[model samples]
Target: MKRLMLIGITVAALAGVAAAAPVSVEIATEPGLNVTAPQKWLQLFAEIGQTGVRIRGMRAGERPRLEELGGSRRVVGVLTRRGDLLLPGGKFRQRDRAALADYFDRVAKDGAEGVEAPRGRFDLTEKQFRTAYDALSEPLGFATKDQPPRAVVERVRDRLPIALEIDRAAERTLNNAGPLAEDLEPLTVGAALAVMLARDGLALTPEHPRGGEVRLRVAVAGDVADSWPVGYDPPASPRETAPVLFEFLSVEVEGFTLTEALDAITPRLGGLPVYWDHASIAEAGVDPASTQVRFERKRTYYKRLIDKLVFQARLKSRLRVDEAGTAFLWIGR
Candidate 1:
């Protein structure tokens, strides 16, 4: 029903602009597949108008699914030889919207020359990779309610020292993942972003050209096998990085959910933040909210208790440090 309303709006908008605009855009979709909203379509065409294309006529129509159009579902704009652009059904972020306009403008003028294929590899020297990885250690905090991942990433990017780029396909994927709800404690910028992105099956991978600048690329997790980890090993010992976890504390839990155990131990960790591998847990079908766990120790430290709890839940805990040399707990399979 909502989709039908959207399609109606698209056709109406097309009719409203058709006589004035030279270029036409066809909004493509498959049954049960989603596409961009009418407002975004209008905004995209407005941006494209700035590109100075000769206006002719505008129209809206549906083609096959993106797969049938020889494009990935993650792709945004598909320009045809007839100067018509077909956009797959999906939401678009500001960056992606602008990217599409610029892309179409170029293709319309230059006949689709110099378009780069979807990037599959990121080459970086060991030092270059390390340099970018170190930036993840920078301390950061994130709190959002019903915000898209792309917007959250843009906020994070403004505060980070490292260069980060969201691939077009990845941007579409993130936007499609819908609004994110997160309230994370202070972790490194990398860890915070990693946790948020994990929920969408996305990841941040570092890249650098020889003698060039270092940057991090956000791509689908499966697409980039060597993406940055949720957390890295702490530079110092557990006692130094997170002394609270090592402090003596008697603990007992016959059957407590993962969240329950974390609640009891979080404050004791002495400001050590904890993050979960959202993608991994989802794929493994592990629901921390209801995953019952048991760990009893007459006399044990918080670290020991945490280990036992996660192990029972079929998860693991890692002591890692962010770029700021702050300690945090990364729990996942």
Candidate 2:
């Protein structure tokens, strides 16, 4: 009898504790809040189980000012870490109530998981900027055989999410440039565009308008003064960025032209495309095809090997990124 009595007492105690603490949402209203706001919130959370929510108004001299929680006109409520949701009451439509409830639920879930939510407009803006950059970094490729600069742009514009614009001057030049003979290796959309544009002495420039849309514009290389490069300098060491280029390889060239050496080396670059700055090369009067290259049969990494070859040919090599954020080697005077 004594054992049964003790078991009954323990069960009663657990029941009382469970009843005392239930899942809930607190809806605290500020002055000027619509009278029906509390009822609406209660109904919204009704199916979400017993929300032990209470509708109460703030006292006249309460501390939090409207400015502290965004503006009254712009904000509906401020979610607090102190387990209270303060709503600045105003007439709310069904859609508005739904939106507020959805946001409230998200905040509660985030809080439970110990995740900090984005605060204010600055964090949101930064997030958007990062997203845009990420999009450009996506790898892209298309057929380049017999495709002229204009045709390449048109084909790429269809695949790209952002807008691609060609000004009148650039269009005239691109249309005249004959179809590119060489099919460029796979590269980022930005890098591919850079190579195609370089063929016509045109360049790509990004335009930002008031509405936060990013558009790429094609302009005459001479007219822009500065254009986006084929790829950016590697952020990491050469070994990390182009590990294959750092691997030792044996090469013996008795008397091969620079052009021939490049043709042989291009296949070993692990798919990295190479762009020739024709304009600068012409200005410097350097002909890679005629310049004879001599290499002693030795084991060396391609990085050093190419450097010596370019130096002998009176040219320089730079790692750069195109509009699509693809890395490529740009060889120029």
TM-score of each: 0.56, 0.57
- Writing each residue's lDDT as its tens digit, candidate 2 over 127-183 gives 444443454555656668787767777777667676566789998998788888666
Candidate 2: segments with Cα more than 4 A from true spot: 1-135, 320-327
Best-fitting candidate, scored by lDDT:
1
The C-alpha local distance difference test score for the whole of candidate 2 amounts to: 0.62
RMSD in angstroms, candidate 1?
17.1
Q: Model 2: clashing residue pairs? A: 33-89, 190-323, 190-324, 230-321, 230-322, 231-320, 231-321, 232-320, 232-321
Question: lDDT for every model?
Answer: 0.63, 0.62
Candidate 1 ranges beyond 4 A from true positions: 1-122, 130-137, 141-148, 160-163, 178-182, 209-213
TM-score of 2: 0.57
The 10-residue segment of model 1 with minimum total lDDT is: 64-73
Per-prediction RMSD in angstroms? 17.1, 19.1
